[model samples]
Target: MTPRPADQRFDVVVVGAGVIGTAIAARLSSTSARVCLLEATDDVAEGASKGNAGITSSYYAAPGTLESDVIATSYRRWDDVCRRLDVPFRRIGAVMAALTSDEADGLPGELANAKACGVAASIVSGDQARRLEPLIGPDCIQGLVLPDEGIIDPMRLCVGFAELAARNGVQVRFDSPVIDIESQDGRVVAVITPQARIETSFVVNAAGLFADQISELAGGTNFKMWPRKGEYWLIDRDWGRTLRHIVFAAPLPDSKGIHVVPTTNGTALLGPSVTDSDRRYDKTTDAEMLAHVTEKTKRLVPSVPMDRAIKAFAAIRPASEKKVRIEVDEVVPNLVHAINRSTGVSSSLGIADRVAELLAGAGLDLTVRTDALDHIPTVRRLLLDPEPETLAALDPRYTQVVCACEDVSAAEIQAALEMAVPARSIDGVRKRTRATAGRCQGSVCMAGVTFMCSLAQNRAPGDVVVTAAGTAGA
Candidate 1:
């Protein structure tokens, strides 16, 4: 692979392209901060951000922490971001269902904690739970309803933020993994990567699971985070609306337990059984975990048949065995450490705003920025509207259905291929246009999008890759 030139510097360098890193990069770009976002993978959100259940959580957070503040505010902020980006989001509530006396008795503490954290949560009986989610097992004895909880497509959210950041002149470098952090006198000087060397004054370590390594590279690794792998199962779109909200089991010391989430893309997701693992990037879903997850999920929603599960995957959650760590590096004066929290997704946007505010407080002039960053992504009405006027207004390609399973049109795929950071691979196209992520799982549409990306990018089919590693052509 040819290395790209990095003849430019920036005010800040965010060393990860996970959900948190993307959000921070996008937010920081709103200022005069010349920012560069670095990612190890070829695309954003290929790590934990891609898999796992994509639920937008409330401050189900433990109270009196920076995370709680951001998580609480982010729940609302995410709703607005999703709207403006035309990213599909569902305001589906979440339920913490209890099936036993012990579980039911433990509910009050969760409710009180939620209230103390200023989250809107209520306790409900089995009948109420059934009424809220009719497919839930009749054995459910009690539950807590979190009305503001939501589900977001993580990849789309990351992509939207990236596109918006690019619109504001922030350079996001894919496949640029920071090899070293060049610093002097406990202040950031530059980030050294194989492809580019980004000179920066401030650095943000939002590398998700590998954040520890990035921190160590930057001369600040006072904390350590272990990876807790969570496996997930995806049901067919036919069972999409069977559940009105995200359903959960009460939290255990190890993990949040299994959840049944109806995603924004009209499909039901299950599992996410948390298990300790040493592998940082082990995304393989284990059979034992799958068996346990399938059994536990059936207890919550009996009608969800295991045979209908089309995809089972895994994501690693960064957890600290010591304590949740969120602090500016004491050793490094200009660096802020935001790493090792399991619920980072819930607090990502809020974390970005807080980091920016902190930098401003530290005498950084973050006020200077472009006049207005326009981020209104076009919503293709081809799938949403079949009316003649709507169809006519869209390029004639709107009439051409490219991926029938997800209702993705040729116009959408073409636009995705031509966007700020064009979809180079099949999964890139999937992230932008939802091409091969449907029930058929790329069996039918893979060839079409791959060929289109190859033709549009003027690359031979051999150059085209699918998903993360596998190749489709040549």
Candidate 2:
């Protein structure tokens, strides 16, 4: 791989390209500062941002916590942000059903917390909850209706933020892991990657699972972050219509419990069994855990078809010693630690705004850019409207279906390859274009997708990776 130019400098260097980092970068791009977004993975949203439940939670936090403020603020701005970026967002609402008396007893506190956080929530009887969501099981004794809560396409949200950031002149560098943070006079000077040393006065540690390590590298806080693995089962789109609302069981003290979420892309998702782990990179799902998740989810929403599950995946949430850590380092100036676990996606925009404010407070020049692009060009999905006659007339490649299951056209895949933050691998393309992420799960489309990826990357089919760093051939 070619090394990055040694003399490259930026006003702000953001570590991690997950939702928080990308959102921060996007916000910073509106300013005159030269910002750089660095991601360790080959593509954006490959970390915790890609997995887990994609719900924009509104009432999941305590009253006086940062999570509360951020989640509440993000709930209001989410739809507008998604609209501007042309990302899929739905205010489908969520139901936190209480099946037992112990769970029902917690509803009052949940409602109180939501009220204190300025979030509108209502405690409903089981019958009312069932009326709202007919699929909810008879075991539900009570429920909390968080009408403002919703789901989003996490991949699109991250990509849209990165794309808009790039459009506004933020340099997005993928596969650029911050190996070390060079500091001088108790302030960060530069972030050293293997390929290049990015000279910047300010560094934002949004590194998700590795935030603690990044903090230590910056000679800042001695915080410890353990990975909390949450596994999910993505039900087929056919069952998505059956589940109209995002349903949740009563929360555990440690976990939010398994959820039944209807995603924006017409798919129902279940599980996300929270299990604490020491392994930062362990995203493997356990069969037993998944079975437990199915049982728990089924109790809340009996209609959840476990057999229709198309995919099972896990994400590691960065569980800090504190609930969330969003503060400028006291020891290391110009280094902001923007870390959150479960609510990262929900609170991203709010956190971004706060981080920018912190950066400005720390003497970083943040003059508003006169020419900053507010909106990114929306990529038209041929699969969304596969009008063969009309689409073929517009682009000949549209007629050639690459992924029949997803109705993904050759033109769509080609367009993903040519995006601002172009897809580098088959999974990248899947995230961007939904090419091989259908019912087949790349069984039928993997070859074609890999071929397109290979063609785009100018590599042999054998050399092209289907997803991440390794797993190139098989």
Candidate 3:
């Protein structure tokens, strides 16, 4: 397919339309910066942004690292953003459990580290851990509790940021990968994408796993990104609320170990078993990994029925050199890096805020306006109970549950498409309204979702596609 035309010369060109890029773009939109958010994929959150546990993180991160500072600041700002955008967020709290004596010994240092990073946390015994999260394993010796920890639908968070940014005049271009970045006299001059050439004075590299590639394109090549693969499982909704907080296993040298999370959609999620892979784009679920996650999670929540697990999926974390690498490009002065490996999702908004401040202080013409990031608050697309008052306020089709498994209605799907940056694919709809992302994983709801999407987009069923590459039958 031929690439699209560039809308205009932008003041800032953000590569990668994942959660971080979207957030950065949204924050930039809050300023007078003319920004272009570009993505290789056809939709936002198509990379690391979509598949993680969606924990808002308690900032139990290592102190003195860029990750620590960004997460601490982001956690504070997240509450306001969630409220303003009407993003579903719950501060269900978090617990970092330690089982072995060695693990127990590490708690003080970790707690001390978190405190240094400005995270409000304290150590508690296994009994206290159980009190905080009743489903915790009895064998757990102790845990670090951060009451401010929480969870938010990461996909929705990205969409919300993109929508709000778009409303404020940020040009978002999907299916436009940055293949080249040109610099002149130590300043970034332009970004070359598959679609068009985007001329910009500044560039923010928030490309997640592809950060190294973008850096290379911009004339720096000191870093490399390794894909740390993580696999997860989702159980029924009734099973989700069984836990009151996010649970965690003590960290190891390479990665944060798997922990069970109760998601905002009322489904219990487990796994994210850490491993390494060479491939940058593989999300294949490993059976052995699934089995391992199930066993480990059962140990944490003995009452959880393994048979009830309804879904299994995997995601990759872009390991960014153990530390976050956010700095002005040494080779290209106008280029900035906003790469984080471990807590990218949790720290996305904060990083955006920092990047904005950094750019503004650098003498860029950035004007922060109240109306710049206009987020039109949306009604709950998946209102499980269609009370008369709700139906009266919502689109009429919401009364008909199109996806029985996820309880997504036709009106909900339509509203998702009608948003400022409405979903353009089944995955987008899944993220926005939970249309086909349930226990059946679209097996049951695929046809209905396709039909509804076709109707909403005014296309025949065959004209509607799952992604740009995959088409549907009419």
Candidate 1, residues 354-403, lDDT tens digits: the string is 88887776667787565747465765645445474576455888777779
Off by over 4 Å in 1: 1-6, 322-324, 368-370, 381-389
Location of the lowest summed lDDT over 10 successive residues in candidate 1: 1-10
Worst 10 residues of 3 by lDDT: 380-389
lDDT, model 1, position 318: 75
The worst-scoring run of ten residues by lDDT in candidate 2 lies at 379-388
lDDT of 1 at 434: 83
lDDT of 3 at 374: 56
lDDT of prediction 2: 0.86
Off by over 4 Å in 2: 1-6, 382-390, 471-474
TM-score of 1: 0.94
Top candidate when judged by TM-score against the true structure: 2
lDDT string for model 2 (92-176, tens) is 8988999999999999998898899888889999999999999999999999999988888899899899999998889999888
For each candidate, the alpha-carbon lDDT, in order, equals: 0.79, 0.86, 0.81
